[model samples]
Target: MKFSKAEIDAVIAASPRTNLPLSKLVLSEERQVRPQGSTPKLSVAELAASIKDSGVLQNLIVVKGARGLYEVCAGGRRLEALTVLAQADDIPENYPVPVLIVPTDKALIASLAENVFHIPMHPADEYAAFARLIGAGKSVEDVAAAFGVTPLVVKRRMKLAAVSPRLMAQFREGQIGLDCLMVLASCDDHVRQEQVWNGMPSWNRRPAYLGQLLTQGEIESDTDPVARYVTLKAYEKAGGTLRRDLFSDDDKKAYLLDTALLESLATAKLQKKAQQIAAQGWKWVEVRARYVFEEFVKFGELRKTRRAPSGEEAAAIASLQSRLETLRARMDALQDHEGDDDNDDREFLKLDAEGEPLEAQLKALQESLCVWPPELMTQAGCVVFVGSKGTAEVKCGLVRPDDRNGVAEVARKASEVDGDGESLVSLPSAKTRPVHSEKLTRRLTAHRVAAVQAELTVRPDVALVALTAQLAHSIFRDDARGYHRPETVFAITAADCQSDLPTAAEDLQARILDVVTEAVDANAASPLAALKKADAANGAEQTVAATGWLPACLRTRREAGMATEETLQDAPERAASEALAA
Candidate 1:
């Protein structure tokens, strides 16, 4: 291990520097000791002249083998030169090239190390050497020091050695670079590593790009064999166009129009539209009124009417007659209550002023009913004729010839006066019928109930109350403007009333009154308006209470536990104190 230069020189001098005869040399057993560099072409004339003039300056390094044969380690070119000279009869045919005997393994290592120091070896040779060192149990540090590199570099070289033979062949053939191989080595997953290695186009594989590919899954991983195979096949079928159009402009458009994406957009749009419709219901009484009007139009046409109505119509007429009778009784009661004094007289006058319009309207209705013709009566059809006497009739089949003539005469008279009342006497087309209570009841089922409930859950305040009320008015009111049957309207009102005042009936009643008054002013249906106002009042109170500054008494009670009532009414407080003590 410590051989000096003199000792090495002495050994070299004693060792015969000659090539044994070709017949004696065991050519078949010769092993490649060192890889050859690219040989420069020399002309035969030049080679021959140089061989004759200078002979071979360097002796071939060989190890002694069996039967006096030699294995060439280095200086193969010099050996070849001598062989050529002998063939041309320029030198002795049996002449031998210089030979120095050493252990075969030592010669191989020395020759390789020497050549590696002087000139570059193929990557394959470097990888093999690293592998040999590792297999010999040499530490990475030892190998690094021997190769004049850091241990990291040694480790990288060792990794190259561990790479699959196929990949190594690629490296050796210069199909891939060391940088790319380093990338493959860094991969923790073997399958992923292999996939990345294989996926790389022969020209594009680079160490820097490998990190990106691994992080992004741009390159298929080898760890998941099945996934890797599937991905690889897909990639191949796609013509290996990776990373070329990954972030192209068209993908953004595709994402925008994707079915799931479009569905989400549509859902948002519908929700917004529904909210708008609900908000409109809250803002405009006319909208609800119009909806009710349309419903009534589907059932019956309004027309001026006279006497003889069916049993159902007669029942409705009787109800209206009773209401008018009650109004008359109230008016007579006001008359009798008058006093002799002047102030009392003035109060009576005010009462009379209010009663005049009521009396006129009732008297007019009475006269209209008294004069209404029986021939004008028919079943409910396009026109519902409500007699001023409170009877109802529908126009059945076609208009009678006499009734038609009468309507025409009325129209002609109204036209002569240029009166707008011409439309009132005209008969509507047949087919329309009064919307029956039973039909209205059938329409108000559990489906509507659920829809209203869902709406309240989203907006649980006055807005919901207003919306439900408007819906009630549409479904229940009796006038052509009121589509809802009375019963259905009552049911909805009850439910809403219950919702508004779940715990306090009196509070609910007050809120309803307030809402109705406000609604009446807003031109909304009285019942619905009342509910909306009640909800608004409650909401306002809640808003004020939530945001208002605390009163001093309440603040003191909270902060100091001082009850205001304790100091007031000391006699009662003393009694309470004595009771507690007792």
Candidate 2:
């Protein structure tokens, strides 16, 4: 088992030999560029030129496979580049290249170690190389140390490499900065990644702007990635601006107080108007009933029809009466002559005269009956009656045996009032009876009022106005802490004082007033304590804890607010609360 150094060297030299052509040996194998693999050991242009001018830079390393074949351990690109050069007439047609034969396992290990340790590559390239090593079963610590970086850095780089190739290209081209790319890499959704990518402008100029646009677009876009990207680009081209007007401390305080008072007045007015309308409805019903009754009385007297006969009928009746009178006169003269004769003759004459009288009476009766009977007039009474007088009297108490005189008097009154002799009467009656029970009426009224109040409270426009007012008041109160003035606060109550109030007049006023009161009360306390309390009340805890409020995020940003009491109070706690709520 033991051997001297000379013996060992002699054994290694005499171990094995191969007759494989160097060209075949180099061309037969393929090598993988590491995952964290750099751009290349050489640039594509440099390698192409080198191959065209001379040949492959270094011998291709290979491992012996089954039979007489070989597998590439490293230097795959060099071989390919040389082959390409040969085919293009840039290199010799049958070029011979160097080769290094090694064991398969050792060749693979060598390829990984060389990629992991030797080059200074981009993070993406390094990550790819590390991944290749790990894929080949290398440990993370080994890979980290080999690259002279921390394990965390190694992991992060690997993650960066794992991002879509399209994103990595964006990074290299500077269409998106490293921070933005890191954010994109952290996200798991492909749609979001694509959105961020497509939202970016071309990398030639304003890369940071493109990144910002992409971030904003992602925030505003809906679930669809393509749609979001398209919308963001369109919005930018359409000239969108994200601008805010910051108020001074004094201005904010004045706004809050005025808003609160205005809102209270508006609410009170609305309640009063609702009450008035309800009262008006009740008054309208009573007035309408009285008017109806008066109208019926004025028009009731004209409803009877006339009973006079036509001229022709009257003339015919008169002629018949004249004929009958003449006949009666002739019969009387004949009867006087017959009385001078025999008793039988006298009796006969008398009978004739009597019969003539009967004829005259019949003719007179016919004359009297010429016109149709007059229609009976309708009468107004407590109860309207239909049927025979006796039946009507019994059912409706129109008349009783003891009150016969009263019935006669009513009949007389009816006949005088109605020109025709009609007995029908219509009396005024209450149209609306008192049927609304006290409890039910009260409940209904209460419900109606409540509904009105609820409707006012829940109107979206109103709510929006209120929220705006409240926000303005909050801003104002914070600004006006120690030097608060009632007039300044009340200024917001005026029509044009607080410009930030929501456009909806009523609700905005109400909400603004409420916020003003709250702000004033808060400001009245110890300024620092009030701010702390406000911050706590505003749900700043979560935001502060997360360190992700907009104020905190922008505190060190280029466009931070000017130093002031309000800005100072907007530290982690307050800013967080506001951001989370927002």
Q: Model-by-model lDDT, in order?
A: 0.46, 0.44
Could you tell me the TM-score of candidate 1?
Answer: 0.21
Alpha-carbon TM-score of each model against the true structure: 0.21, 0.21
CA lDDT, candidate 2, residue 429: 35
Error of 2 at 84 (Å): 1.4
* Model 2 misplacement above 4 A: 1-22, 26-50, 53-55, 63-71, 103-105, 115-120, 123-582
Evaluate model 2: give its lDDT: 0.44
| lDDT per residue as tens, model 1, 118-143 | 66578778778888978999898766
Q: Tally clashing residue pairs in candidate 1.
A: 23
Question: Relative to the unseen true structure, what is the Cα RMSD of model 1?
Answer: 34.5
